[model samples]
Target chain A: MDSRAQVSIEVALVAGIAILVAVSLVNINFERLNLARELGEGGEAKMVATLIATSINTVHANGAGFELTLSESKLNFTELTDVDQGTGIILPIIIDNTRRKVIVGRNMSRTGHKGQWNVSVSMVPNNVVRQDPTARYPEVTIRNNGTNVIVYADSSKVRVVP
Target chain B: MSSNRAQVSIEFIILVGALLVMVIAVFPYILKTNELNKALSAARDGATFGAGIRGVGYQSGSVEAPPGRIKIKSVILERLGRCGNLECYRFRIVIMMPSYYSSNSSYVNSIRSTIRNQALRFVYYAFNGEYPASSVIYRVNTNYYSFNATTDVEYY
Candidate 1:
């Protein structure tokens, strides 16, 4: 082949490899950023779960008549930008009576990820946990009603008496 | 034609040299930043999980010590020991430091302090009760391999 042709082929091969590397790097960075975001969301979810679990345990431990109100001040559900409400229960917080644990999951539609980024913590209260069907967000009232810990979450418009 | 080819070769050599120099200069900074982020993330996760475990342990009043393990990136967290009383306890946080920071004392100290500060702050917020922030000690041991941080937590 001619010298000019040889040089042109060499440059094309090098440029092709460079493009491939650049594309790969971009992909890797994208994945890394997504993972970091997921990790962050998981951490936040854990924090919320911890707060809820601790409250349930504390209320149950303190005996009956002990009531704790977790307004936006305590349970910052805002931190969970895209939290899943779970199946059948329209509440983000789920009290698993069978497993004796509190599970907090994320809403997959907004997260754009398929990972199970839920946070679950074991609870001491074995009694049935009743959640207000109309419960929404920003506030949750947990009360030790002598037998079971009643948990209700709803907006300010709804009465939170437990 | 010969002279033109010689000039092209020299230009190629200079271009390659410049690219190498740029990579050499920027690679360390990127690595250092990555390490710092990892350390901070580890510290935060460590504190959060540590406090969560402690909270559960406090609730159950189990003297057997809560058995749990959390792995975050290059960090590992587990039960250290029982603090005699059920309310007081310790948990171990092991953070693996890359060899990059091992050679530089300042980097090691910076990473160590970063982990210590974040861990202490989160633990205090989540675990402290009547005890002051100062009372909760975040003991950090830095070797050439990893950062071993332990916190004496009290739930009141």
Candidate 2:
């Protein structure tokens, strides 16, 4: 080939390689952003779940009932009632199945996917978990459920109003 | 010939500089993504396993902050350890039995609530995506208080 033709061929190869590298870098950047958003959602969802769980736990722990006002979000509960509490007369806890719930998917409950996370929380184990937190909880307020309110969070001094 | 060599060296410098920029910009993202992915995976697993934990964490009105005072009921905080590299947090369920009202219904209820709340916090934060596992169950408590730790992690 002539010198000019050889130069043209070499330029084309270098340009082709450069284009490939640029495309790959762009793709990796996109993937990182997408993955960050996805993981953030999961983390946020789990944080909401943890917040709700703490509230319910406080209620059951105090063995009293209080109005649990949560922002609109998906909620799931498992009957933490002592299966072995033994049949005997004792102080009654007013927590129903609704209040005792430890919600997992906070977004699903509020978003279009209503009633989608109705899985029986029967899977009991001790270990780590996967969470996708994307529930927007601007505020959590406690309301009056009834008399005999034992304990309350979201407050520095949680007093029981009997 | 010298002019041509100068142009080639400039090209080489440009390539090296571009590589350095790419490394500086992209490597941190890769490392962060890896850490986040690890955190998400561990959190998910912990949440699933923690769901079955029928326990609580209890802090006396006197205690302030996490790894504070864990009132002993069925829950017990063995020890609290800080992170050497990162800030690691944990729940230590101290075995504080208010002897005056050991049998009192209201007092027992108070202790019970403390246990439940503390247990929950332990699992939740212990599995936090950040930091290493520096928290340990205190040695003072026996296996009896671990409360079927195999299935429920009853470290109260």
Candidate 3:
């Protein structure tokens, strides 16, 4: 082969290697983007779960009495109303004492896909209704697409409600 | 012939151009991996801090705010998950504490109230997201008391 042909062969080899590297990098980036999205969703799920748990705690604290009844498709809070403090400022807001279903993809839409988000929330109450124990924790289970993440939060610690 | 040599050089140039295109296409993936690693580290740190605070609250029966408060915040970028948009994650740190009205309460109700108010300030500083100035409202019955003292967060 002449010197010119040799140069052409060398260029072709270099170009091929560069293309391969570039393709690999692109794949890596796509993977990373997906991870970031999942993390964001995970964060959202945790936030929602915390909100629900704290709401329950607030109801228990302000109410004359309340009951958490779990059903097959829903979790209900019965008798969930605060008594009139007589001061008449409506000290605590009266919450709806009804069973709320834990539906995952009820209102949220998935981006770039035909499938919707798989959402589920479960509550596990620690036994501290009658007694004033230092530990009163609620276990929350949030699931998305068969992947379940469990978070245990202590209402006393977070003190999200007044 | 000199013409043949010129043709060879042109081919070499074409090859080089193709290689450059490939590199440009792949560079994003490499950068994304680095970002993903950073996000994971931050998330783990926040999770650890949250867990630690809860542990202490459980053991000691009460936790105060500001100096004694434990706050954790984590963020996730758009490059990590299957989703394509950027998303921010925030958690309200929960610690086990003695009830304010209970006997031998760790802190006075006034002091606990101050702590609760300050926790949000710390959370705002930790995460880069928008939190609504107005408190989010929820509907509950008249029987339960709203804590409203825990951490509050907003993400856009």
Candidate 4:
């Protein structure tokens, strides 16, 4: 009602509005950063998936007796909170015969929430062996066994002995 | 003196009210613009990735690339029979993206244009300097957010 009271109220309202704006701006910035991070992770995962798909398709195209070994390291799985802890333990590649696609990313099973940052690429070959990695540095062997293409991950098979 | 002071106070209140009204009017526009920008970014990245995949497939029949917000719907390759001594090939690739809220289609159109150019380049190389007859057609179905490229090669 009084002049002094009016000025004090005005100051308080202005200060409150300024604080609100500041907080809102900060929150918006944080959201933007998180979105960027997610996009980057998804892009990386897709790249890895594409690489595996290309290799498998190439081997199948070359036909039987055409074998090529692809080291897991070539995939270059980037570390993310959603993926497995480290390189040695994580099995990062899966060939889905039913879907006729290849998925590249480790599944996250922490905190009872299961999800994986992965990408799937459709392939030409339908008959392909499904093999899981057993060793740390496994090399994937893609072979077209006349009728079906075989894909298996093995560390010891890095060198073939006659 | 008291009337003058009252007049100044009333004017201040009116000014603050007008400022509030303007802020409210522009807020939604700002948010919409932000959303449009995000959509454009995603679409740009997706287009680049898809073009890379098309390039790889042309070079070695193997495709390698990342998908940001676009997904490859299907890839079809038709032999188109034979062309004299050389072989003729026709391939179609479809990429799906999310639609944007804005009506300005220029952003997406530019991306589509870039993809068409890339397809032409791939076709030129596939012809292998023989100058074989080639056609690169691009169709953008906005309703389905699908971008399709059908490339045909026929020897002259």
Candidate 5:
């Protein structure tokens, strides 16, 4: 082929590839920003859940009755059972990604969904505790119960059970 | 014809060099803008989180922390200061709540305590302890649910 013809073909091919790469890059950035927004929203939900779990643990630790208001929060209570008078709830912060959920801190986890997190503050059994973190206080086990696409918080204090 | 080709090659090299320089110069600005935006979003979310927990102290009946689990009236951005840093933002947030009783020192003290503790925790979590923040609360009886009570929040 003539030299001019060869140069013309090379320029065309390079231009085509550049355009393709540019288009793909734009799409990638768009998706990234969308994910960032989702992360922000999920992070917000996780923060609220952690706050509730922390409140429960704090109340149990001090044996003091206290109330906290959760506003603009898309969270629901399961069983709505009070932390047992003697055995406070122990909540384990579980992080699972097969479900694509990230738990912030040990007590809170969130996913891409705008709303779908469960925090359980349950009574700890005396005999069946896989690991125990407390001797003075009746242990509370806070963790995700079942698979409701949720995370559970069961702790007399917000901590990992030993 | 040979001279023309040489001139064309030099032109292409110059064009490529100019593009490279533009990218190197502009990339930092883009990164800085993105970081600033992130900081702003984090601040807004943090303020909202703190406002949501304003009532945690009021659940007890006695002066046992004195908060019967209060309500947040409103949260607004009072001022914002921009500084030269990767995510530089110094801002003030104002929070309001309603007062059933007259503005008493004891009641105000409880509220201040509630705001300080809960707000600090909320910001710490929401911002992931990434920024330095300080909050101050003041309660004043204006009228019947006329958006009363206040907390001054400073974040850097």
Candidate 6:
């Protein structure tokens, strides 16, 4: 081949290889960035789930002896006495529950992710027709981001009511 | 005829030499870039694992140790406060991978260095919290292969 033709071929080959390498590097970088984002999202979800579980356990152990009512929208531990409502006792319980949800929400919002969690308490009456003395209400379905968590409070379990 | 043949051979040799040089110079950059990307991805993966472990620990009422794959060095949990009426915990997880940092190649080394410093900070910011704006000291060996990490947690 003529010198000019040989030179043209060489230049074309070099350009082709460079373009190929450049394209490959760009693709690799894009993939890595995506993986990083996914990892961040997964981590946030797990944290939220943990907080939800702890709160339910605390409320089950200490909430005042109140009739448990479960509805589609609310789980009520009602009839809390004046003492039970005081900051000395109830504030910690409230704090425990609220904080768990808040952390989950804040993290999810910041990370642009979403998760769902729920907790509930219900009473099992002592008597069906006011006859049995061995029965008591127990808390149920305290889930942290869908992790099945069960915490029960036996009025019998309370040795010295605080 | 003999002289003409010799001239063609010399010209071919020159063309080959130029091609080899171009490949040598550019191929390393491409390969180095690839290695750096791989390390960055690994660092990000480790960070994600750290975050997940922290969350699990807070929920389970026990510190969930980071998975073995993550090579965690430390975990910190902070009690932040209630979310509405529920308790919350903030966790930090740190992991180390020696292979990522001790690379002799500049491309890999730069990426490894960047990831080592930024992984946790990225997680913290992603979680909507600010990281302390100070730089942490790191010691890297000649091969770019060792790492250390520290994580912090808060619960409310």
Q: Using DockQ as the measure, which candidate wins? A: 6
lDDT against true structure, model 5:
0.36
How well is each residue in B1-156 modelled by candidate 1, as lDDT tens digits? 878877877777688679779877997676544433444443555344433332222111112122132222333344344333321222344444335434555533443443344464433322221112342345432211123355331111
Show pairs that collide, candidate 1: A83-A107, A84-A106, A84-A107
- Model 2 gets an lDDT of 0.33
| Candidate number with greatest TM-score | 1
The best-first sequence of candidates by TM-score reads 1, 4, 5, 6, 2, 3
By lDDT, the best candidate is 1
lDDT of 6 by residue, B1-86 (tens): 76886698688879789978987989757664454344344345535533333323222122222222324444444445544443
Off by over 4 Å in 3: A1-12, A64-112, A123-162, B1-156
| Chain A TM-score relative to the true structure, per candidate | 0.64, 0.38, 0.36, 0.59, 0.32, 0.30
Expressed as tens digits, the lDDT of each residue in B18-80 for candidate 2 is 877887799767654443333333323332222221111112343211222223322222223
Give Cα-based local distance difference scores for all models.
0.48, 0.33, 0.33, 0.46, 0.36, 0.36
- Angstrom error of the Cα, residue B118, model 6: value is 17
Q: What is the lDDT of residue A14 in candidate 1?
A: 86
- Kindly indicate the candidate among 1 and 5 with the higher TM-score: 1
Q: Model 4, range B65-124, lDDT digits (tens) per residue?
A: 323243445445444554444334333545454454123344334334435444433232
Cα lDDT tens digits, model 3, A1-162, are 478577687787779878966663453344334334433443444344345545444444444333332231332111211112111111121112221212122111111112222222333332122112222322322111122111232332112211
TM-score of each: 0.41, 0.26, 0.24, 0.39, 0.31, 0.28
Task: Tell me the tens digit of each residue's lDDT in model 5 across A50-160.
Answer: 554453444334432332333223332321211221111123343333332222221111111122223222322211122343332222322222222111233432323
Q: How much is the lDDT of residue A76 in candidate 3?
A: 18
Can you list each candidate's DockQ? Answer: 0.02, 0.02, 0.02, 0.02, 0.02, 0.06
Model 6: CAPRI class: incorrect
Candidate 3's clash total is: 45
